[model samples]
Target: MITKTFKSESTIQTLQLVQQELGADAIVVSMREVPAGPIWNPWKKSAVEVVAVSPNDEPQVRKPQPPMQMPPSLEVAEEIPEIEWDIPAKKKTAKLPPPIKLNLNPLSGQPAPVTETVRMTEPTAPSNDRYSPPALKKIQQQLTQQGVESSLIERLMELSAETLSPSTLADVEASKRSIVQLMGAELRVQKGAGAFVSNNVVAVVGASGSGKTSVIAKLALFFRQGLHKSVTWVCADTVRTGAIAEAKAYTSALGLDLKLVYTPQDLKEVFNGEQANDLFLVDTPGYNPCNEKQMIELGALISEMPSRCTYLVAPATTKEADLHQLSASLGVFNIDGLIITKLDETYTFGGIYNFARKSNTPLAYFTSGRETSRNLETADPMRLVSALFGKEWNK
Candidate 1:
């Protein structure tokens, strides 16, 4: 038969090509899928390859020709002598023992339940300590060293276990991408830039030196310029040095108003003078979470505006232990979301990620540098996962 090969993006197309060239009588010999592009590129699309043969050239089977009788002289040349039979007797076969029988009747003369037998035969669930592939173990170690909590790392590894394979793991880039996708699934991000809105006073609170003011200034600029909303700055931090002057500098530049409130009663007056279509950005003094008096006063101030969006701003450099402590102490504010700042000042981001995940807080924004104009960004799941995996956030 005349043999030929045909290739196409699908099996149907390949079969059509084979039929067109070899006619309707063509026979398919074999078919398989192969990479359409270079083999090294795993993302390349696959093509179907088919081997076919034309029926017109199929080989014919010949009927066995009658065996020509051997010539009489050739057949008679080999004369042989007769031999005597000497056979032995057959050995006896061995038999197996009979099967044993058990009594199903109980001493009480009651019928046995069928469920007991099924329960005894049912299989058990697999152990939690499953065999982790070397690739997954390596990734777990990487996450651990990057300051991720053991619980969170274990969870991420468990979720990623199914996606790993010997071949896929060999490609380092592919493994990392898988990790990004896995961790991205766990990350929580705020939906939009609605943190600052009219009728809700936006407040920021955290431990001292957590870059609360920087975040506030960046947010003011964002709402004023980016969202094109009128921003009125409120500096509740009357005790901090240059707090008023700092608020003045930003407000004067943006041509917005600023208010200084030392007490919740004073804050109430500002609330009474609220204007239409105006965003209120309140900057509270750095709180000492352990200081019961300070926490109480912070809570009191937050209580003034029953409808407020309070963000707990924390530096990315904070340790996991301290993050938990802050969450416990400052949880009384009824925090609406989180704003992570000073991202450029630290290398490890696992602590924050674990904190947010465990506490179920939605990350609202990320601030890297001191530049109030360009450093603020809306929180993103991919960016957080990239940071966790040692990849550049921008990349």
Candidate 2:
């Protein structure tokens, strides 16, 4: 029987195509929605794929063959005829060079030379494991060890298996690069803080102890020292203990003015006479995601700054579910970017990638180490990718 597949933007259109190709009495074997558009466009709409066949088509049957009678006694010839045949010579193909290994170092902030290579004598053997072709199995294990969600790791393995050729899959280094590139493509890093400083007001909010205050200090130095812009520290975090004192200490060291605001009106007054060129970095109070009252109050303060570029500060050590809950709780603020903190404390960072994927928020910066000025780094996709492969973000 003959069958055909049809794809269209809509189910109705797919049905029409099936009918056109297979006639009115067509039977649909399967129908499903598949991603459409170019590979680079992740936000592309889905299209319907339908497999159909005509009902009139019938399977061809084969007739049975009659058995032939065989001689009772087998005849053995004393002399066998000698036959000579000419066989063509086999063509020799040139061997291709192995792919270069890439080192993922987050501290260098530059591409480093490959420090390791796969020795031919120690080649990875193929396996019957679920995430097989040993190279891909290694990739899966690395991702899992880095605390990446199991579902995402499986998806990455599938992508690696699908995109890499058998020869490439045999090479662990090539498979590693392919998997890293796949993750890097999904990560979205926004322009540096200097670019967003033009928005005039920058705000950061998070749960208590998420290093929100430290991130603010780092941003202050980044704008003042790095970008050469005047920065005003606004403290709206009245809920957290010592939050005000911490903000003051950071501001005092940076030689920047600090504005203390307890209410939305106070925050409004602080921004009423803001300078056009000066960057205002606002620090918000930490609130529990489960506390509706605190969330409402926090949202009210954020509403005061109509032109603010808000960032949701998340610790790298946060679990996937908690990260999702935090983002969902603060999603009402229309989070413009994400700031990942506490990178120095944890080794795994796959949760960050998962959060970015779910929220569709671009990462702004990543903070690590104890030093404020040197710790803040503009979000780098390769850095996160490096961490997923057991390379910690050292700097």
Candidate 2: lDDT over CA atoms?
0.77
Worst 10 residues of 1 by lDDT: 111-120
Each prediction's TM-score versus the true structure = 0.64, 0.65
**After superposition, candidate 2 runs with Cα above 4 Å error:** 1-131, 192-198
Best candidate per TM-score, number? 2
Model 1 residue pairs with clashes: none
- Writing each residue's lDDT as its tens digit, candidate 2 over 1-395 gives 57778998876556556544555445566556778999899799878877766656752222222222236796533222122333446755433233222221212333222132322456688885564788988878888877677887888787778877999999998888888888888878776554546487999999978988888888988888877778999999976788788888889988999999999999999977767678899999988999999989998898999998899999988888998999888888888888999888877677777888767889889888768778788887778887877776773
What is each predicted model's overall lDDT from 0 to 1? 0.74, 0.77
Return model 2's CA RMSD, one decimal: 25.4
Worst 10 residues of 2 by lDDT: 98-107
